[model samples]
Target: MSMPGKRVQGGKQARGRAGLCQALLSLLLFTLLLLCVPVRAEPVLTMGYVEFPPFFFTDARGQAQGTIIEMARKVTQRAGYQLNPVYFPPRRMEKSLAEGRIDLWIGLDTFELMAHNTLSSKTVVSTIELRAYHKPGKPPISHLDQLAGSQVGVYFGYSYGGWMKRIQDPASGIEPVFVRIRSQAARMLTSDRIDYLLDYRGPFESQVDSNITGYLEYETLATYNLYFVLSRKRPDTYQLMSQLENAWRQLKREGEI
Candidate 1:
């Protein structure tokens, strides 16, 4: 007769093998289940932008539509991120970006703006031509100094590539008339409320009344490259920025940018 102890040992060995096999099989099934489940993407980002019509603005139907809006959408989508745009006044938008309430800003980048808990993308978002507008009969402005002693209308909160410093200096003698919207600047210029109105020419053409433009003369001040401004307040700030840069590169390569 066979030894009972030996038989029990064999049975233990068999059970041990079965247990291990079952464990491995369960692990395989769990991994397969995980593979079958879709991986979730990062949360939708809040893109903060000012109302620069034809660049970024809410239309008559209350829907945000514009070149910058479209560009932001493409970049975010390509990077596997969904964008939710929120309108903010210029100052509020800057503060929101610093506080991480707004994840991204697509606009002109400046050293002063980048100092506020923000980093700018290497990829150029767009190029904007800053122009100074005055009445047709007025003397043309070839330089900022020419406008000295005259009131120059400028959009509030716009960096204007730090030319704002020169514009605001007492010695420059430029009395700045700050307006909230481009339309206001256009109106002020047309009605002779201000000596000159400074604005980004691209949007000013479409946003301002055509008739008003006919009566005005403009000279290009400078062109600035728009960049993607990312907030430093978020943990994934660098990662998101990298993603955006990569997406921009791919789009550029494909000529889709």
Candidate 2:
């Protein structure tokens, strides 16, 4: 009883609806695929350091340049992270590191006494001798007791170790004049204001060129290890430290160190 032309029109309409449903389903499937994919987070790493030559220092251009800086960049890059080196003078850097203002601090000596609990990643370097610089003709103090009566020059708030601390205590016989800057200490030693200036031998030798060497003479007396310190409270500290230690060993094996 239905007309042939009406039947043909109904068939076309049904086909059109079926095509639209298929198109919408295809779009929904595509959207679901996009939602299931993961997005990558940006890689960022913050490093803190003080001005120590041949390890971490400001070059003539005022940019941080040193062997450790280069090594840090290489290691972080391999781990898919970027290095953001922040330079602060020794005291300020220590404060910032304690406050969690920085992620890592390089060239930290093993004996640094921090108020906060800090974790060390690995031994990055070693410095032999807390060397003493004196005038060319002065007798070197080979024994700790020899320095007892002298005014020793040290960087302000710097500590060598428990042994040095005990020796340096005023209650003990030795009295030292602690200076704020390395240059100041050196100048004081040259001018005879202080009997001697104590510093790490490696950096001291590397930084003091021939022009400056004429006024200073050095003697090595103690040794210590340097390491990278991280805030123990950071959740990523342990994992990152492990990764760094592994990377460091690999680099050493590969002669990159």
Candidate 3:
């Protein structure tokens, strides 16, 4: 009777020890599983742009490529965010950004954007030199007054450094013709449909055909600084802008941008 009681007590202790060991093993496996799993990435920020080569445009393989696009990617990554570049037509790009359908835009800091309920970065990420291109036979332009009495082909929806008002004034004798795309403006000039084509030098250098460029004469009209524009409609608009601004400053200091 004493031996049976001792054996029963031993079995109960053994079962309790085994249960505790199994639980410990299970917890270890669960912890290892968590460590092996990857953490989710940060949310993506949508970058809006129109085709302005050397600043933002699509390559032949349909990949987004340009100076500002490259900078934006680095800045967003540094800010713990991912970037998703989206293409829009010139007019639509502005509207989408204003309505907050697009989160950010990398372009000129303009007065019109102020009324769009947007905030712009203080960092001057880039600058665009507006240029007037004419046929080689025509005299090179050095001043805005020289464009008087001429039909100038310009990009639609562009401010052109607020020179539009001056160009459109009846007393100025300048007639403005608008093109939806830069390529159209180039074609119009090359085909002699317009007296002059006004565009940016950087874009012309990046996209215009070599043969076409040889036939054109260009003059710098104005230079405008580019900034990151954030739409006010986002709930975290101020916070997002602050993150981007900090990232940009850091990148500048690191000489990475």
In the order shown, the candidates' Cα RMSDs to the true structure are 9.0, 7.8, 5.8
TM-score against truth, every candidate:
0.79, 0.73, 0.79
Q: What is the lDDT for 143 in model 1? A: 82
Candidate 1 vs candidate 2: the lDDT winner is: 1
lDDT to native, each model = 0.87, 0.73, 0.86
The lDDT, on a scale of 0 to 1, for candidate 3 is 0.86
Report lDDT (Cα) of residue 165, candidate 3. Answer: 74
Q: Weakest 10 consecutive residues, lDDT, candidate 2?
A: 108-117
Let me know the TM-score candidate 3 reaches against the reference structure: 0.79
User: Which residue runs of candidate 3 sit more than 4 Å off their true CA positions?
Assistant: 1-32, 35-38, 111-116, 169-171, 180-184
Off by over 4 Å in 1: 1-42, 111-113
Q: How would you encode candidate 3's per-residue C-alpha lDDT over 163-190 as one tens digit per residue?
A: 8777778898888998776666788898
Candidate 1 is scored at a TM of 0.79
Better of 2 and 3 by TM-score: 3
Tell how far residue 123 is off in model 2, in angstroms.
4.0
lDDT (tens digit, per residue) of candidate 1 on 65-104? 8988987888889999899999998778888888888899
Please report the TM-score between candidate 2 and the true structure. 0.73
Residue 125 of candidate 2: its Cα lDDT? Answer: 51
